[model samples]
Target: MQDKSKEAAILRSWHKNVEPWTRAVRESEIRSRVAVSDAAIVNAIIAQSPKHVLDLGCGEGWLVRALADLGVTAEGVDAVAGLIDRAQQRGGTFSVMSYEEFAAGAWQQAVDCVVCNFSLLGHQLVEDVLAAIATLINEKGRCVIQTLHPAYSGEPYCDGWREGSWQGFSEDFSDPAPWYFRTLATWLAMFKGCGLQLEELIEPLNAESGSPASIIFVLSGSSRK
Candidate 1:
């Protein structure tokens, strides 16, 4: 029940934050994103040299636009209609679809890559989405995920729920959504459970602090095992 409400709160927060969120991405307001995670996730996906990529939970579709510019056929889907509208207006193919819809196999085409860039925010729902992604990609395909490292969670390192906030951002952002946190071991176990094998774990660093700004997990279908 708690998980369900937190999940719903996430959607509500995004719905209310479309404008500020879009502006932040467009203006590169987030320091961590501007400094490292954005390039890290993009480079990780490009390394696979995918032909068609799906940007799951893609907010305003900056990643889609970026990949499209690099000649990849990229499509983005978001639960928020406003974000999808903004994404379409800005360029790139986008649709309004929730993670539940996606996990239920809403997207029929098999792609070479699927990226969830700091977008996997649910509990069991995220597990469902990961399983869907594993089956949605070709055998040789990969799923690139960029998210805050477990170490950054700052203590009592175990799997649980955590409240999210927009402390460092501008005043416009509000209704901060709560997010589920997973420790490193739990993360790996979840991937394995979803039939995804970890290909690489990249820790993109912040130049100033020299600590990892975020972690990138490069995973591939585990059928080869």
Candidate 2:
């Protein structure tokens, strides 16, 4: 078992430097693509009447801001202090803390919905995180998770393959942080084992490249009663 504290520190350092560059890239072309995909997922959950939502691993609290715009009470948590600071500056209620720490505290059983948008991957303790998320959801509550498609996992981080072409590995620039690249089957099985039933799975087409590189999952927990 990796020490959660050590993992958090490493991730924080990685993001502290990378986030500025990422934010710029996001603003250029990535933001619009992410907005389209996230908007779809957020809209679907809003239709279901979400009241209290938790945005886990929320980088800069984009989803939290969006949910607040839609009149939902939302809070975001992330391990990167710089990102959390940026999120706060954007008017998001965010805390700089690891999910493991938060889940072990008073907020464990309090949220109505939990959403992890493209941030839960690369963690060594994914199962533990899923279990923690399950505990956070109220009965019949929902959970949403998104990750890079396994087909895209091994690709070079910088080589944009015209959207659909599967480019083989060129350079592994992924953060040295450990990541689990699971197939769709493995993703489903892990969630099922944690007692959440799959509600929907969406493979998003990259707007610029027109390739499928992201997978979104909507899940519901078993009734607590």
Clashes of each: 0, 1
lDDT, residue 214, candidate 1: 89
lDDT of 2: 0.68
Score each candidate by Cα lDDT: 0.92, 0.68
**Model 1: residues with Cα > 4 Å off, grouped in runs:** none
Give the CA lDDT, 0 to 100, for residue 158 in model 2: 38
What TM-score do all the candidates reach, one by one? 0.98, 0.76
Candidate 2 per-residue C-alpha lDDT over 81-103 given as tens digits, one digit per residue, 9 for 90 to 100: 77788788778688887666765
lDDT (Cα, tens digit) per residue for candidate 1, span 89-205: 988789999999998999989999999999998899999999999998897899999888999757478888888899988999999999999999999999999989999999998
Residue 152 CA error for candidate 2 (Å)?
Answer: 4.5
lDDT of 1: 0.92
Q: Pick the candidate with the highest TM-score.
A: 1
